[model samples]
Target: MSPIELNKRQDTILQIVKENGPITGEQIAERLNLTRATLRPDLAILTMAGFLDARPRVGYFYSGKKTMTTASESMMNLKVGDFQSLPVVVAENMTVYDAIVQLFLEDVGTLFVVDEKSHLQGVLSRKDLLRTSIGTQELTKIPVHIIMSRMPNIVYCKKSDSLIGAAKKLIDRQVDSLPVVNETENGLEIVGRLTKTSVTKAFISLAETHDL
Candidate 1:
């Protein structure tokens, strides 16, 4: 079935799953102001499109594994420019101590190291700082660039890419976060970061719908 054929209601059902999956048909109906019987066809189409899953006891759920495929297809149907996030970044010249402090204060596991021009230079993790600090290195004088994982090795995702794609990369690399880059006219620039924690939260949010 062509995605273009999906009606507004079907799209809405898919979105509801994307944002809140592992939900029951009754729950979805309530959110859309419809009865369960009215939503059956919509749910059927979404499940056929690989956007949703229905289980005996669970009722219905957004396919976490299939979210990437559905998201990529849905991008063509939705406004591409609608979703964007401004990335938080740090300078390459920042001290290790400062990076550590910032990581704690911001409650983030990774930090992006950027040049003065706001170009992505590298990435630093808590492990990197701790490893360096164990050697009796002076944290205040050391630049983050000296220890950061340099480019060509940096695993990143474009903002245009779906969250599922980014999450897959993070899982495959066994990393905690991914830098979101913008493919500008000049080069790739860091715009945001997506972390495992955020992905977990999204999943939890989706699952919570069933509890209610």
Candidate 2:
């Protein structure tokens, strides 16, 4: 399961409650310099999501429950394969110049490389190609496999992996994309691609599902 994500204001309210427990609604509002009417929605949401509790004649206190229904809850439950797009790939033996052309023609920042048997071999990014094409370097002579990130060094995802896990990996590794692959006895077989666009699409779909 993924963490229950909160908006900026919600986070602030949570911090305030943690630091000053049993805080009254009016006091909480004063700390944030917001009117009680404006902060009501957040308070109600926090209470409903089990993040806060209210007592008669008292104030609001932290519930100590971590789970909540977030705007991205639908997205977090989705599988990586559900949002993966058709992968763009090039032969490992393809020239760097040709790889550049494909990268542009396909309008993608990264490309997966494959062996003659169509097994996953490596990954090539725009930066990788650009780095090799600089100065007097001969891009036409250099094979993609020479500069591509080889297997075992590549970060990938399985179809069954959760979407939130994928997002975390993307942020943690600082990579633009991840290959959706299948593990075979021989090696991983690239099936699809998961990029920032994929995550955006998932979010849009989730929002639509909620009629929001």
| TM-score, every prediction | 0.59, 0.64
For candidate 1, report its TM-score: 0.59
lDDT of 2 by residue, 34-148 (tens): 9775676567556645678878678888888665665555455567766777799999889999999999999998999999888889999878888888843788888899899
Model 1 has a clash total of: 2
Q: For candidate 1, list the clashing residue pairs, or say none.
A: 87-191, 87-192
Kindly give the stretch of ten consecutive residues in candidate 1 with the minimal lDDT sum.
75-84
Q: Give one digit per residue, the lDDT tens place, for model 1 in 11-123.
A: 68878877887789999999999977566545644654566777977777777434434433432332111122335578989988899898888877888888888888898
The per-prediction tally of clashing pairs is 2, 0
The candidate that achieves the highest lDDT relative to the unseen native structure: 2
Candidate 1 overall Cα lDDT vs. reference? 0.70
Q: Which run of 10 residues does model 2 get worst, by summed lDDT? A: 203-212
